[model samples]
Target chain A: MHVDINSYFATLLQQENPALRGRPVGILKDVGRTCVIAASKEAKKLGVGTGTSAYEAKRLAPEIVFLPAEFARYLDATKRLKKIFSNLVPDYEIFSLDEAFLNLTDCTRLYPDAQEFGRHVQQLIKDDLGEFVTSNVGISWNRFLAKMAGEIAPKGSVAEITAENIDHYFATTEFKDVCGIGRRLEKRLAHLGVTRLYDLHFVTDEQLETEFGPYWSKELRKMSEGKEPSLFAHHAKNEQPKSVSRSITGFSLAKDEAEIRAVMRNLIDEVMYKAREMQLSGRWAAVSLSGEGQHWWSHQRVDMPIRHAQELFDILYHQLYSQWDRTFNVIRWRVVLSDLGSWETTPEPWLPDWQRQEKLEQAAQELNKRFGLFTVRSGVLLQRPLIRPEVTGYLGDRQYVLGP
Target chain B: MYQTIHESIEVAGVFTPGKFSPTKFRWGKKTFAVEAITLLSRERDGLVPIHHYSVVASGTVFRLSFHPDNLAWFLEEVWQEGA
Candidate 1:
């Protein structure tokens, strides 16, 4: 079963403010950002949606009200929603902030009828969350079909796809409706004169391999038959991250070395803080900069675990920034730490100087934790507007916050 | 339209074991009676948790936040008919 909140962020705002209810609304990532991250159902009907520019959205629906995203509200609601869902369905996977998948194999006795179960869950959400916030539930034998069913289901309704009705849905649905088939894949499939899932019957296996390569060819065949080979693989919870990265676009382009260095220091601070929070260390570090229609990126493998911001910054500084031509103003900066391994499992330090630095890092982390992040930041970040930590719309690091 | 007014304010409210609801608050020279608390959410700054209350009052929506560490109330924002 796949349950997805309808217009999650925008609907939550509507639920919060009575005046916003029944009106078109667009959600922005921040006050200054122009991209509409999410749109209320009313706004979507008028052609305003995610990725729609604020200017375009205003033109599409002049009466639309815009609100900056309140991630705290959404995350709080998700925590409560998860509590309600876990109580009823133990075997569940959080697909995103507003979506979840439940494996009802063990709960069949408790929920004999999946459709009834879906409705019961919806009622619980309405009762615990507000009346304006609604979810669409879809049930099927696999996650892929269940997600598709949920997409087709009406807002605040339940849908189920069985083996008998699978073919009917495949014939009626377009290739784009499938979860894994993106626009690029759709165009590729269309080039071969395949418009629907049912059209895969006409194309030979060799042809699919030639177009989609070997791995996706097998996946596509399974998708055409409404089967998901790795349906259970996504259920793995509390999995440590393989890599950690943080990137930010400057409010205005940085024209000099001082500005670029400050931004890099801030980004590295964030990356290292996250790594420390996860109790992980990286063997690889990368830095990338973008501006003036040109991009520069470099990465290197370090001899020791990249545990500190200063350490990673030193490597990136020598490789990328020191060699920079300074021809164009940089508009964005990104720092990445990959090849992660458990810091807790690593052997104890043997060098006195290294041990002293480690203790200093620990003390600094402790102070920052109590006073707030960046309270003990490097002097380079002083007097600068602290970027602080932020939650991504994708909720990619959900496992670090919520356990299985 | 909406306006951001992150100013400290005086508020009358009900405070129970686990509930904190503001009934009325004074901003500038006017006191607005909260008709309804439409939503409540909590966010963290460093280690301090700030609780926000979205309320309807005087034909407008107001976002009020409470700082537990300082036991202070702030009028964060207000939304009216137009800019």
Candidate 2:
């Protein structure tokens, strides 16, 4: 069973503004100044989403009001909400911070119906916490259709997807719309001239094994007709990244070597900062610069992992700059920390008193975490600076990686 | 009610953002003109400090801090002094 906190973000916005109750609200999104992420159901009905231009949203929904996405705050609320959810429901998996899945098989006897279970969850979250809780239950014979059933179910509703009705449902269901039938599968199915569930359902076991990987293909056949294993608690402990990458596509494209070096220097600085955040070090790097003449040049390096953020930047920039005489005059350039050079084993190396600089950056990250970015930066970063550029799209944000 | 904190920290500015190594903030030799503001963001369930930076016409950089402790006061001050 899955639960959705309906309009999770919009509800947060309304919670902040009492007068905005039941009114149209949308989060004015920014990827270094780009688009909105989620909008209220009202605004959504008016065609608002991640890519909806501000002017367009304004035109479509005149009553729509804007709220900036406070990721840190929302993260806080979700943690509280998740804890409450975990306590209330046994064996729950967080689907998204805003959603959860609970295996109701064990509790079916205790709770008479899925409806009652859903309502209890809904009320528990809304009453105890300050956010809205809206959920739908899909009692399916299996997982694939259950997920689909959950998505299409009306608000505050439930649907049964047992063997009896699974066929009827898939007969009209679009293959592309199915959650697991990703684009590659769709293409393969198209090549085989099989585009619908019906087309795949009757295939023989021999053909299935030969065509797709025996394990996954076999699993697919079972899931398609509404029979599959329940998903287990699959949360993997979050691992500190081996490498952190930050890229920028300059809004004002660089025309020459100097600008490219300036940007490359900044990119190295960003990647190094993230490495330090995770207390990881990188032994290898893949740095690339792209430019106007359809020109692109990239360099890869292997060295001992460096944790001192400033020194990492200094080494990378010095190398990247040497390579950029011709290739860095482009629209986009990036630096990536690859092959995590080392783990958190040691602290900054000591140098002459005057040469000591690494500890200062470590202090800067903590200070900024207390404050914000650029509160303190390497003096070199301050030399001939470049402003962050904006990204314009529904899916990709140029400015997303260039952040704290 | 909203007021603007005029301090403009260089974001995605001449320097790349988040590309710095030693990802934490430093006091360095000089303290900022305005201390970073600190707040316990509900989202993070921890303290989040924001350093507000602004630049003058002459390209000199000035910095300020924003935190939970000073959020209300900062908002009020911005409102009063805002253009």
Candidate 3:
């Protein structure tokens, strides 16, 4: 079963403001400086959607209400909805902030009928999350079909896909309806004479492999049959991510090397904070800068697993400074720590000062945890306005922090 | 239009069995009865817990923030209808 909220952030805004109900509304990361992160149904009718610039959105919908995103409030709503799902099924995978999939193979027998069960789940969400908050529920044998069903389902409704109806659904659906086939892939498939989901059935495996890689070709074949790829069988389990990154956007390009270094320091602080929270260490550190019509990325594989933010910063500083050109203004900066492993599996440094440095880092972590983030941050971060961190969604490399 | 104003205010609410819900508040010389609590959220300011409330009163919505550290209430924002 797949449950998805409708216009998640924008709907939440309307749910909070009665004046916003039935009106075009869009949620922005900030009022003056960011793009539209989410748009309400009314706004969508005006051709305003996520990724639309605030200025463009206003031009499209003159009366569109733009509200800053309240992530803490949205997260609170997600938590409440999660509790409702917990009551329905014991096993579920949270695909994103507004979407989740439940494994009902073992629990479907508890209900008299699957459609009734879906309705019950929808009603429970509405009852618990106010009448304005609504969801689409989709029920099928696997996650992919269920998600597709939910996407095609009407707002505040449920759609169930079974073997009897799967072929009919695919015959009418477009290639983009499938989860993995995005706009780029859809265009690629179009060039291959596979414009619809039904068209995928006619393409040979070798042809698909030649166009897309071997992995995606097999996945597309399975999706064409209304069957999920075998790799998604363990969807419910939480697997450790291979990399964690933090990035900042919307800011102008840094004017000098010092400004860039300060931004890098702050970015590393955010990544390391999450790494320590997860108790993971990485062997590769990467730094990327984008702006002024140029994009540069540099990375270094360290001799030892880097656990502290300072160590990661040291590697990135050397790699970035050596190649950085002051002529180009850097509008965005990103720091990534990849090749991760459990901290317990990491070997300790043999230097005499290693223990002392580790103790200092631990103490700093404790202080920041006791206080708020960056309460004990480096001096380099203090030269500018504090870079507030946010969790955009599950897809980005940004840190995901739950609760208050 | 939304205007930002962080000013101290007084709120009247009920403390019922582990929860607090504001019913009215006074800012300057005017008192607005909270018709509905549109949204309520809690977030941390450093180590201190801050409660934020979005309330609609007299056909307008106001964002109220409460700081537990000093037990102070702040009128954070005002959204006048049709503004």
Q: Which candidate number would show the highest TM-score if scored against the true structure? A: 1
- Alpha carbon deviation, residue A358, candidate 2 (Å): 6.5
> Candidate 2's residue-wise lDDT over A146-205, tens digit each?
666666677657766666777766776676546667788778767766676667777777
Higher-ranked by DockQ: 1 or 2: 1
- Per-residue error for A244 in candidate 1, Å, reads 0.9
Q: Over the stretch A33-91, how does candidate 3's per-residue lDDT look in tens digits? A: 66898999899999998899989999999999888888877776776777777787888
lDDT of 3 by residue, B1-83 (tens): 56888999999999999678899999999999999887777776367878888899999789999998889999998986655
What TM-score does model 1 achieve against the real structure?
A: 0.94
Worst 10 residues of 3 chain A by lDDT: A395-404
- Per-residue error for A268 in candidate 3, Å, reads 0.7
Order by lDDT, highest first = 1, 3, 2
Look at candidate 3 and tell me the lDDT of residue A124: 83
lDDT of candidate 2 vs native? 0.55
Better of 1 and 3 by TM-score: 1
Clashing pairs in 3: A253-A330
Q: Which ten residues in a row have the lowest lDDT in candidate 1 chain B?
A: B37-46
By summed lDDT, the worst window of 10 consecutive residues in model 2 chain A runs over: A395-404
| DockQ per model, Cα | 0.62, 0.13, 0.53
